[model samples]
Target: MSLRKRLIACLDMTDGRVVKGTRFADLVDAGDPVGLCLRYAADGADEIVILDIGATVDARPALLALISRAAAVLDIPLAVGGGVRSYDDAAAFLDAGADKVSINSAALADPALVSRIAQRLGSQSVVVAVDAAAHEGSWRVRSVAGTLETGRDAVAWASEAVERGAGEILLTSIDRDGTRSGYDLQLTRAVADAVRVPVIASGGAGSAADVIAVLREGGASAALLASLLHFGMVRLPELKARLAESGVEVRRPLPAPRPEEVAAWRG
Candidate 1:
Protein backbone atom coordinates (compact mmCIF):
# COMPACT_ATOMS: atom_id res chain seq x y z
CA MET A 1 0.00 0.00 0.00
CA SER A 2 1.13 3.55 -0.70
CA LEU A 3 2.07 5.72 2.25
CA ARG A 4 -0.65 8.13 3.26
CA LYS A 5 0.04 11.88 3.25
CA ARG A 6 -0.34 13.18 6.79
CA LEU A 7 -1.95 16.55 7.59
CA ILE A 8 -1.11 18.29 10.86
CA ALA A 9 -2.65 21.41 12.35
CA CYS A 10 -0.31 23.54 14.45
CA LEU A 11 -1.58 25.56 17.38
CA ASP A 12 1.01 28.20 18.22
CA MET A 13 0.27 29.04 21.84
CA THR A 14 1.50 31.91 23.94
CA ASP A 15 0.15 32.71 27.40
CA GLY A 16 -2.51 30.05 26.72
CA ARG A 17 -3.86 31.64 23.57
CA VAL A 18 -3.51 30.28 20.06
CA VAL A 19 -1.60 32.85 17.98
CA LYS A 20 -0.28 32.90 14.43
CA GLY A 21 1.85 35.24 12.35
CA THR A 22 4.14 35.56 9.37
CA ARG A 23 7.89 34.93 9.87
CA PHE A 24 7.34 34.56 13.61
CA ALA A 25 6.32 38.17 14.05
CA ASP A 26 3.10 40.16 14.42
CA LEU A 27 1.18 37.30 16.01
CA VAL A 28 -2.58 37.63 16.31
CA ASP A 29 -4.77 35.60 18.60
CA ALA A 30 -6.46 32.66 16.95
CA GLY A 31 -8.36 31.11 19.86
CA ASP A 32 -8.05 28.95 22.93
CA PRO A 33 -5.69 26.06 22.32
CA VAL A 34 -7.91 23.47 23.93
CA GLY A 35 -10.98 24.53 21.96
CA LEU A 36 -9.06 24.59 18.70
CA CYS A 37 -7.62 21.14 19.29
CA LEU A 38 -11.06 19.73 19.95
CA ARG A 39 -12.37 21.35 16.80
CA TYR A 40 -9.48 20.06 14.73
CA ALA A 41 -10.00 16.57 16.06
CA ALA A 42 -13.63 16.78 14.99
CA ASP A 43 -12.47 18.09 11.61
CA GLY A 44 -10.42 14.92 11.05
CA ALA A 45 -6.97 16.41 11.53
CA ASP A 46 -4.38 13.66 11.54
CA GLU A 47 -2.48 15.13 14.48
CA ILE A 48 -2.14 18.34 16.48
CA VAL A 49 1.07 20.25 17.18
CA ILE A 50 1.11 22.61 20.16
CA LEU A 51 4.02 25.05 20.14
CA ASP A 52 4.62 27.12 23.27
CA ILE A 53 6.33 30.02 21.54
CA GLY A 54 6.93 32.02 24.71
CA ALA A 55 8.02 29.38 27.16
CA THR A 56 11.70 29.22 26.26
CA VAL A 57 12.29 32.95 26.22
CA ASP A 58 10.30 33.67 29.36
CA ALA A 59 11.63 30.64 31.22
CA ARG A 60 8.08 29.67 32.05
CA PRO A 61 6.48 26.26 32.22
CA ALA A 62 5.81 24.60 28.86
CA LEU A 63 2.03 24.79 29.30
CA LEU A 64 1.56 21.18 30.37
CA ALA A 65 -1.80 22.08 31.86
CA LEU A 66 -3.07 23.35 28.53
CA ILE A 67 -1.63 20.32 26.74
CA SER A 68 -3.31 18.06 29.27
CA ARG A 69 -6.63 19.73 28.61
CA ALA A 70 -6.19 19.41 24.86
CA ALA A 71 -5.19 15.76 25.14
CA ALA A 72 -8.18 14.96 27.27
CA VAL A 73 -10.42 16.38 24.59
CA LEU A 74 -8.60 15.09 21.50
CA ASP A 75 -8.27 11.49 20.38
CA ILE A 76 -5.65 12.27 17.75
CA PRO A 77 -1.95 12.33 18.57
CA LEU A 78 -0.41 15.45 20.07
CA ALA A 79 3.15 16.76 19.60
CA VAL A 80 4.35 19.56 21.84
CA GLY A 81 7.31 21.82 21.04
CA GLY A 82 8.98 25.10 22.07
CA GLY A 83 10.65 25.91 25.39
CA VAL A 84 11.47 22.24 25.77
CA ARG A 85 15.05 22.61 26.96
CA SER A 86 15.65 19.84 29.43
CA TYR A 87 14.73 16.20 29.95
CA ASP A 88 12.39 17.17 32.77
CA ASP A 89 10.49 19.58 30.51
CA ALA A 90 10.15 16.93 27.85
CA ALA A 91 9.04 14.37 30.41
CA ALA A 92 6.52 16.80 31.81
CA PHE A 93 4.91 17.23 28.41
CA LEU A 94 4.70 13.45 27.98
CA ASP A 95 3.31 13.10 31.47
CA ALA A 96 0.73 15.71 30.58
CA GLY A 97 -0.32 13.59 27.57
CA ALA A 98 1.90 14.59 24.69
CA ASP A 99 2.78 11.70 22.40
CA LYS A 100 5.93 13.46 21.14
CA VAL A 101 8.19 16.33 22.21
CA SER A 102 9.87 18.55 19.62
CA ILE A 103 13.14 20.31 20.35
CA ASN A 104 14.81 23.00 18.25
CA SER A 105 16.93 25.67 19.92
CA ALA A 106 17.77 23.28 22.73
CA ALA A 107 18.87 20.57 20.36
CA LEU A 108 20.92 23.01 18.29
CA ALA A 109 22.63 24.33 21.41
CA ASP A 110 23.36 20.83 22.64
CA PRO A 111 22.93 18.17 20.00
CA ALA A 112 23.34 15.38 22.53
CA LEU A 113 20.03 16.38 24.10
CA VAL A 114 18.23 14.70 21.25
CA SER A 115 20.09 11.44 21.85
CA ARG A 116 19.34 11.55 25.56
CA ILE A 117 15.63 12.14 25.00
CA ALA A 118 15.49 9.48 22.31
CA GLN A 119 17.12 6.96 24.62
CA ARG A 120 14.59 7.58 27.37
CA LEU A 121 11.40 8.24 25.41
CA GLY A 122 12.14 6.21 22.30
CA SER A 123 13.04 7.69 18.91
CA GLN A 124 9.48 8.14 17.76
CA SER A 125 8.79 10.36 20.73
CA VAL A 126 11.37 12.95 19.68
CA VAL A 127 10.99 15.42 16.84
CA VAL A 128 13.62 18.04 15.99
CA ALA A 129 12.21 21.34 14.71
CA VAL A 130 14.30 23.32 12.22
CA ASP A 131 13.08 26.78 11.35
CA ALA A 132 15.12 27.64 8.27
CA ALA A 133 15.42 30.69 6.10
CA ALA A 134 17.00 31.05 2.71
CA HIS A 135 19.88 33.38 3.37
CA GLU A 136 22.78 34.34 1.11
CA GLY A 137 21.58 31.74 -1.39
CA SER A 138 21.72 28.97 1.19
CA TRP A 139 19.22 27.56 3.70
CA ARG A 140 20.34 28.53 7.18
CA VAL A 141 18.81 27.39 10.44
CA ARG A 142 17.22 29.88 12.82
CA SER A 143 16.65 29.53 16.53
CA VAL A 144 15.12 31.34 19.53
CA ALA A 145 11.69 31.37 17.92
CA GLY A 146 13.14 32.44 14.57
CA THR A 147 14.61 35.64 15.96
CA LEU A 148 18.23 34.49 16.01
CA GLU A 149 20.11 33.13 13.06
CA THR A 150 22.22 30.04 13.72
CA GLY A 151 24.53 30.39 10.72
CA ARG A 152 24.24 26.67 10.18
CA ASP A 153 23.23 24.83 7.06
CA ALA A 154 19.71 23.42 7.53
CA VAL A 155 20.29 20.17 5.68
CA ALA A 156 23.49 19.51 7.59
CA TRP A 157 21.83 20.16 10.92
CA ALA A 158 18.90 17.92 9.99
CA SER A 159 21.23 15.08 9.07
CA GLU A 160 23.11 15.39 12.34
CA ALA A 161 19.90 15.56 14.34
CA VAL A 162 18.60 12.36 12.78
CA GLU A 163 21.89 10.61 13.39
CA ARG A 164 21.56 11.68 17.01
CA GLY A 165 18.24 9.75 17.10
CA ALA A 166 15.60 12.31 16.21
CA GLY A 167 12.78 10.29 14.66
CA GLU A 168 11.21 13.19 12.78
CA ILE A 169 12.04 16.68 11.54
CA LEU A 170 9.53 19.53 11.61
CA LEU A 171 10.99 21.71 8.84
CA THR A 172 9.46 25.17 8.63
CA SER A 173 10.31 27.71 5.96
CA ILE A 174 10.63 31.02 7.68
CA ASP A 175 10.43 32.89 4.39
CA ARG A 176 7.29 31.14 3.27
CA ASP A 177 5.47 31.53 6.55
CA GLY A 178 2.02 33.09 6.30
CA THR A 179 2.54 33.68 2.58
CA ARG A 180 -0.32 31.37 1.55
CA SER A 181 1.43 30.72 -1.73
CA GLY A 182 2.92 27.26 -1.25
CA TYR A 183 5.78 25.52 0.52
CA ASP A 184 9.41 26.14 -0.31
CA LEU A 185 9.77 22.92 -2.17
CA GLN A 186 13.50 23.16 -2.83
CA LEU A 187 14.40 23.71 0.79
CA THR A 188 12.03 20.98 1.98
CA ARG A 189 13.34 18.44 -0.51
CA ALA A 190 16.93 19.16 0.50
CA VAL A 191 16.24 18.52 4.17
CA ALA A 192 14.06 15.51 3.42
CA ASP A 193 16.86 14.04 1.38
CA ALA A 194 19.31 14.58 4.21
CA VAL A 195 17.22 12.83 6.86
CA ARG A 196 16.19 9.21 7.11
CA VAL A 197 13.07 9.88 9.15
CA PRO A 198 9.89 11.63 8.10
CA VAL A 199 10.08 15.35 7.24
CA ILE A 200 7.00 17.47 7.95
CA ALA A 201 6.94 20.52 5.69
CA SER A 202 5.55 23.59 7.43
CA GLY A 203 4.79 27.20 6.40
CA GLY A 204 3.23 28.69 3.26
CA ALA A 205 0.31 26.32 2.93
CA GLY A 206 -2.70 28.16 1.49
CA SER A 207 -4.96 25.45 0.08
CA ALA A 208 -5.36 21.75 -0.56
CA ALA A 209 -3.45 22.10 -3.79
CA ASP A 210 -0.59 23.62 -1.84
CA VAL A 211 -0.58 20.58 0.41
CA ILE A 212 -0.45 18.30 -2.62
CA ALA A 213 2.34 20.34 -4.14
CA VAL A 214 4.48 20.03 -1.05
CA LEU A 215 4.06 16.26 -0.78
CA ARG A 216 4.79 15.75 -4.44
CA GLU A 217 7.49 18.32 -5.14
CA GLY A 218 9.09 18.74 -1.73
CA GLY A 219 9.26 15.01 -1.07
CA ALA A 220 7.75 15.57 2.34
CA SER A 221 5.94 12.76 4.11
CA ALA A 222 3.58 15.20 5.83
CA ALA A 223 2.53 18.86 5.83
CA LEU A 224 1.78 21.15 8.74
CA LEU A 225 -0.85 23.88 8.40
CA ALA A 226 -1.65 26.95 10.48
CA SER A 227 -3.10 30.13 8.91
CA LEU A 228 -5.22 28.33 6.37
CA LEU A 229 -7.03 26.20 8.91
CA HIS A 230 -7.21 28.87 11.62
CA PHE A 231 -8.77 31.40 9.22
CA GLY A 232 -11.30 28.89 7.81
CA MET A 233 -9.76 29.16 4.36
CA VAL A 234 -9.71 25.39 3.93
CA ARG A 235 -12.22 22.82 5.17
CA LEU A 236 -10.85 19.42 6.07
CA PRO A 237 -13.44 17.35 4.20
CA GLU A 238 -13.09 19.33 0.98
CA LEU A 239 -9.29 19.23 1.22
CA LYS A 240 -9.37 15.46 1.65
CA ALA A 241 -11.70 15.16 -1.33
CA ARG A 242 -9.30 17.13 -3.49
CA LEU A 243 -6.37 15.05 -2.39
CA ALA A 244 -8.23 11.84 -3.17
CA GLU A 245 -9.24 13.11 -6.58
CA SER A 246 -5.64 13.99 -7.33
CA GLY A 247 -4.61 10.38 -6.53
CA VAL A 248 -2.69 11.23 -3.39
CA GLU A 249 -3.07 8.71 -0.58
CA VAL A 250 -4.91 10.35 2.29
CA ARG A 251 -7.25 9.33 5.09
CA ARG A 252 -10.72 8.54 3.79
CA PRO A 253 -13.25 11.24 4.57
CA LEU A 254 -16.21 10.63 6.89
CA PRO A 255 -19.43 10.09 4.97
CA ALA A 256 -21.43 13.23 4.25
CA PRO A 257 -24.68 13.70 6.15
CA ARG A 258 -27.89 13.27 4.15
CA PRO A 259 -29.96 16.47 4.01
CA GLU A 260 -33.40 14.75 4.21
CA GLU A 261 -32.28 12.38 6.95
CA VAL A 262 -30.82 15.29 8.87
CA ALA A 263 -34.02 17.32 8.46
CA ALA A 264 -36.16 14.41 9.71
CA TRP A 265 -33.82 13.85 12.66
CA ARG A 266 -33.87 17.54 13.55
CA GLY A 267 -37.69 17.67 13.16
Candidate 2:
Protein backbone atom coordinates (compact mmCIF):
# COMPACT_ATOMS: atom_id res chain seq x y z
CA MET A 1 0.00 0.00 0.00
CA SER A 2 1.26 3.48 -0.84
CA LEU A 3 1.89 5.88 2.01
CA ARG A 4 -0.78 8.53 2.35
CA LYS A 5 0.09 12.22 2.61
CA ARG A 6 -1.46 13.68 5.74
CA LEU A 7 -3.20 17.04 5.50
CA ILE A 8 -3.00 19.11 8.66
CA ALA A 9 -4.56 22.53 9.22
CA CYS A 10 -2.92 24.82 11.73
CA LEU A 11 -4.84 27.27 13.92
CA ASP A 12 -2.68 30.10 15.27
CA MET A 13 -4.50 31.61 18.23
CA THR A 14 -3.92 34.96 19.87
CA ASP A 15 -6.36 36.49 22.33
CA GLY A 16 -8.81 33.68 21.53
CA ARG A 17 -8.90 34.58 17.85
CA VAL A 18 -7.60 32.56 14.92
CA VAL A 19 -4.85 34.50 13.16
CA LYS A 20 -2.62 34.09 10.10
CA GLY A 21 0.55 35.84 9.05
CA THR A 22 3.69 35.41 7.05
CA ARG A 23 7.00 35.01 8.84
CA PHE A 24 5.07 35.35 12.10
CA ALA A 25 4.60 39.09 11.69
CA ASP A 26 1.54 41.29 11.18
CA LEU A 27 -0.88 38.53 12.08
CA VAL A 28 -4.48 39.19 11.15
CA ASP A 29 -7.49 37.56 12.70
CA ALA A 30 -8.94 34.76 10.58
CA GLY A 31 -11.94 33.65 12.66
CA ASP A 32 -13.00 31.93 15.81
CA PRO A 33 -11.02 28.78 16.56
CA VAL A 34 -13.92 26.42 17.06
CA GLY A 35 -15.78 27.50 13.95
CA LEU A 36 -12.67 27.48 11.75
CA CYS A 37 -11.60 24.02 12.93
CA LEU A 38 -15.11 22.64 12.37
CA ARG A 39 -15.09 23.96 8.81
CA TYR A 40 -11.69 22.41 8.10
CA ALA A 41 -12.77 19.09 9.58
CA ALA A 42 -15.83 19.06 7.35
CA ASP A 43 -13.60 20.02 4.45
CA GLY A 44 -11.59 16.79 5.00
CA ALA A 45 -8.52 17.82 6.95
CA ASP A 46 -6.80 14.74 8.41
CA GLU A 47 -5.72 16.49 11.62
CA ILE A 48 -5.66 19.94 13.21
CA VAL A 49 -2.98 21.75 15.17
CA ILE A 50 -3.68 24.65 17.54
CA LEU A 51 -0.84 26.94 18.54
CA ASP A 52 -1.43 29.52 21.24
CA ILE A 53 0.74 32.31 19.89
CA GLY A 54 0.68 34.31 23.09
CA ALA A 55 0.57 31.55 25.65
CA THR A 56 4.27 31.04 26.27
CA VAL A 57 5.06 34.66 27.04
CA ASP A 58 1.84 35.68 28.69
CA ALA A 59 1.66 32.68 31.04
CA ARG A 60 -2.04 32.51 30.45
CA PRO A 61 -4.20 29.47 29.94
CA ALA A 62 -3.22 27.83 26.67
CA LEU A 63 -6.69 28.17 25.17
CA LEU A 64 -8.01 24.95 26.62
CA ALA A 65 -11.55 26.22 26.13
CA LEU A 66 -10.96 26.65 22.43
CA ILE A 67 -9.44 23.19 22.25
CA SER A 68 -12.41 21.68 24.09
CA ARG A 69 -14.80 23.34 21.69
CA ALA A 70 -12.83 22.07 18.69
CA ALA A 71 -12.59 18.52 20.05
CA ALA A 72 -16.32 18.49 20.75
CA VAL A 73 -17.09 19.48 17.18
CA LEU A 74 -14.36 17.78 15.11
CA ASP A 75 -13.87 14.02 15.01
CA ILE A 76 -10.29 14.00 13.70
CA PRO A 77 -7.16 14.22 15.84
CA LEU A 78 -6.28 17.50 17.56
CA ALA A 79 -2.78 18.56 18.56
CA VAL A 80 -2.35 21.52 20.93
CA GLY A 81 0.93 23.39 21.37
CA GLY A 82 2.41 26.54 22.94
CA GLY A 83 2.86 27.45 26.61
CA VAL A 84 2.73 23.80 27.58
CA ARG A 85 5.60 24.04 30.06
CA SER A 86 4.76 21.37 32.59
CA TYR A 87 3.23 17.94 32.90
CA ASP A 88 0.10 19.53 34.34
CA ASP A 89 -0.23 21.78 31.31
CA ALA A 90 0.15 18.83 28.99
CA ALA A 91 -2.40 16.83 30.96
CA ALA A 92 -4.83 19.72 30.86
CA PHE A 93 -4.75 19.82 27.08
CA LEU A 94 -5.14 16.04 26.85
CA ASP A 95 -8.03 16.10 29.28
CA ALA A 96 -9.55 18.88 27.27
CA GLY A 97 -9.56 16.42 24.34
CA ALA A 98 -6.29 17.01 22.53
CA ASP A 99 -4.88 13.81 21.05
CA LYS A 100 -1.32 15.14 21.24
CA VAL A 101 0.61 17.88 23.04
CA SER A 102 3.39 19.67 21.12
CA ILE A 103 6.22 20.98 23.24
CA ASN A 104 8.67 23.58 22.00
CA SER A 105 10.46 26.07 24.24
CA ALA A 106 9.71 24.00 27.32
CA ALA A 107 11.05 20.81 25.87
CA LEU A 108 14.15 22.58 24.61
CA ALA A 109 14.75 24.08 28.01
CA ASP A 110 14.38 20.70 29.66
CA PRO A 111 14.67 17.77 27.32
CA ALA A 112 13.73 15.36 30.08
CA LEU A 113 10.20 16.76 30.04
CA VAL A 114 9.57 14.90 26.80
CA SER A 115 10.29 11.59 28.42
CA ARG A 116 8.21 12.47 31.46
CA ILE A 117 5.17 13.37 29.37
CA ALA A 118 5.59 10.25 27.28
CA GLN A 119 5.79 8.12 30.40
CA ARG A 120 2.67 9.70 31.84
CA LEU A 121 0.73 9.61 28.63
CA GLY A 122 2.39 7.67 25.82
CA SER A 123 5.09 8.21 23.24
CA GLN A 124 2.53 8.65 20.49
CA SER A 125 0.87 11.52 22.35
CA VAL A 126 3.95 13.71 22.55
CA VAL A 127 5.14 15.91 19.69
CA VAL A 128 8.21 18.17 19.79
CA ALA A 129 7.64 21.41 17.93
CA VAL A 130 10.89 22.81 16.61
CA ASP A 131 10.88 26.39 15.36
CA ALA A 132 14.02 26.74 13.27
CA ALA A 133 15.50 29.49 11.16
CA ALA A 134 18.25 29.46 8.57
CA HIS A 135 21.12 31.39 10.10
CA GLU A 136 24.80 31.69 9.20
CA GLY A 137 24.46 29.00 6.53
CA SER A 138 22.89 26.56 8.97
CA TRP A 139 19.45 25.94 10.40
CA ARG A 140 19.54 26.84 14.09
CA VAL A 141 16.78 26.05 16.54
CA ARG A 142 14.74 28.96 17.89
CA SER A 143 12.55 29.13 20.97
CA VAL A 144 10.09 31.36 22.87
CA ALA A 145 7.89 32.07 19.92
CA GLY A 146 10.86 32.23 17.57
CA THR A 147 12.52 35.08 19.41
CA LEU A 148 15.57 33.39 20.86
CA GLU A 149 18.20 31.40 19.03
CA THR A 150 19.51 28.27 20.72
CA GLY A 151 22.61 27.92 18.51
CA ARG A 152 21.75 24.28 17.90
CA ASP A 153 21.51 22.71 14.50
CA ALA A 154 18.01 21.66 13.47
CA VAL A 155 19.04 18.11 12.56
CA ALA A 156 20.69 17.46 15.92
CA TRP A 157 17.72 18.73 17.89
CA ALA A 158 15.30 16.56 15.92
CA SER A 159 17.41 13.50 16.67
CA GLU A 160 17.45 14.34 20.36
CA ALA A 161 13.72 14.92 20.41
CA VAL A 162 13.05 11.44 19.11
CA GLU A 163 15.45 9.90 21.59
CA ARG A 164 13.59 11.69 24.36
CA GLY A 165 10.35 9.97 23.30
CA ALA A 166 8.76 12.35 20.84
CA GLY A 167 6.58 10.37 18.48
CA GLU A 168 6.38 13.23 15.97
CA ILE A 169 8.30 16.36 15.10
CA LEU A 170 6.53 19.50 13.94
CA LEU A 171 9.36 21.35 12.20
CA THR A 172 8.71 24.90 11.10
CA SER A 173 11.09 27.19 9.20
CA ILE A 174 10.75 30.62 10.72
CA ASP A 175 12.41 32.20 7.70
CA ARG A 176 10.02 30.62 5.22
CA ASP A 177 6.90 31.04 7.33
CA GLY A 178 4.18 33.16 5.72
CA THR A 179 6.14 33.62 2.50
CA ARG A 180 3.63 31.59 0.48
CA SER A 181 6.57 30.69 -1.72
CA GLY A 182 7.44 27.10 -0.75
CA TYR A 183 9.05 25.04 1.96
CA ASP A 184 12.78 25.02 2.76
CA LEU A 185 13.43 21.63 1.34
CA GLN A 186 16.94 21.23 2.73
CA LEU A 187 15.86 21.97 6.29
CA THR A 188 12.89 19.63 6.06
CA ARG A 189 15.04 16.82 4.68
CA ALA A 190 17.69 17.35 7.33
CA VAL A 191 15.26 16.97 10.20
CA ALA A 192 13.40 14.11 8.56
CA ASP A 193 16.66 12.30 7.94
CA ALA A 194 17.81 12.74 11.54
CA VAL A 195 14.58 11.59 13.19
CA ARG A 196 12.96 8.20 13.18
CA VAL A 197 9.49 9.53 13.97
CA PRO A 198 7.09 11.24 11.62
CA VAL A 199 7.98 14.81 10.59
CA ILE A 200 5.28 17.36 9.80
CA ALA A 201 6.66 20.13 7.61
CA SER A 202 5.44 23.67 8.23
CA GLY A 203 6.17 27.08 6.67
CA GLY A 204 6.35 28.20 3.03
CA ALA A 205 3.43 26.18 1.69
CA GLY A 206 1.74 28.49 -0.82
CA SER A 207 0.22 25.96 -3.20
CA ALA A 208 -0.73 22.33 -3.56
CA ALA A 209 2.51 21.84 -5.42
CA ASP A 210 4.37 22.93 -2.33
CA VAL A 211 2.60 20.24 -0.32
CA ILE A 212 3.58 17.63 -2.89
CA ALA A 213 7.19 18.78 -2.80
CA VAL A 214 7.30 18.61 0.97
CA LEU A 215 6.19 14.99 0.99
CA ARG A 216 8.25 13.79 -1.93
CA GLU A 217 11.40 15.87 -1.90
CA GLY A 218 11.60 17.04 1.69
CA GLY A 219 10.86 13.57 3.07
CA ALA A 220 8.10 14.97 5.25
CA SER A 221 5.38 12.51 6.16
CA ALA A 222 2.84 15.31 6.57
CA ALA A 223 2.41 18.98 5.75
CA LEU A 224 0.85 21.65 7.95
CA LEU A 225 -0.86 24.57 6.28
CA ALA A 226 -1.95 27.88 7.77
CA SER A 227 -2.43 30.92 5.53
CA LEU A 228 -3.33 28.93 2.45
CA LEU A 229 -6.23 27.12 4.07
CA HIS A 230 -7.24 29.81 6.57
CA PHE A 231 -7.78 32.41 3.88
CA GLY A 232 -9.45 30.02 1.42
CA MET A 233 -6.63 30.47 -1.03
CA VAL A 234 -6.45 26.68 -1.44
CA ARG A 235 -9.54 24.56 -0.93
CA LEU A 236 -8.91 21.15 0.58
CA PRO A 237 -10.80 19.12 -2.03
CA GLU A 238 -9.13 20.89 -4.93
CA LEU A 239 -5.71 20.39 -3.41
CA LYS A 240 -6.46 16.73 -2.78
CA ALA A 241 -7.54 16.33 -6.37
CA ARG A 242 -4.26 17.80 -7.58
CA LEU A 243 -2.31 15.49 -5.30
CA ALA A 244 -4.24 12.45 -6.51
CA GLU A 245 -3.55 13.42 -10.12
CA SER A 246 0.14 13.69 -9.35
CA GLY A 247 0.27 10.07 -8.16
CA VAL A 248 0.35 11.00 -4.50
CA GLU A 249 -1.80 9.00 -2.10
CA VAL A 250 -4.48 10.96 -0.31
CA ARG A 251 -7.75 10.27 1.43
CA ARG A 252 -10.74 9.58 -0.78
CA PRO A 253 -12.75 12.65 -1.61
CA LEU A 254 -16.17 13.07 -0.05
CA PRO A 255 -19.10 12.29 -2.28
CA ALA A 256 -20.47 15.15 -4.30
CA PRO A 257 -23.27 17.10 -2.71
CA ARG A 258 -26.66 15.75 -3.72
CA PRO A 259 -29.05 18.12 -5.52
CA GLU A 260 -31.53 17.93 -2.68
CA GLU A 261 -28.85 18.52 -0.07
CA VAL A 262 -27.59 21.62 -1.86
CA ALA A 263 -31.10 22.93 -2.40
CA ALA A 264 -32.02 22.35 1.24
CA TRP A 265 -29.03 24.31 2.40
CA ARG A 266 -29.82 27.09 -0.03
CA GLY A 267 -33.42 27.15 1.06
Clashes (N, CA, C under 3 Å) per candidate:
0, 2
lDDT of each: 0.86, 0.87
Please, what's the RMSD in Å of model 1? Answer: 6.3
Give Cα distance to truth, residue 137, candidate 2, Å. Answer: 3.7
lDDT of 2 by residue, 1-267 (tens): 576888999988887877763332223433677777877787888899998877844435548777887889888899998789899999999999999999999998999999999999998999999999988787999988889989988889889989989999999999999898899999999888888889999999999899999988999989998889877778888988888888888887667689999888953
- Compute the lDDT for candidate 1: 0.86
Tell me the spans in candidate 2 whose CA falls farther than 4 Å from its real position: 21-30, 56-62, 255-267
Q: Give the per-residue Cα lDDT of candidate 2 at 246.
A: 87
Candidate 1 per-residue lDDT, tens place, 1-267, comes to: 677888898988788777853332223423667777767777778899998877754435438778888888887899998888898888988999999999999999999999999999999999999999998777999998888999999999999999999999999999999898899999999988878899999999988888999888899999998888877788777887888888888877667579986888852
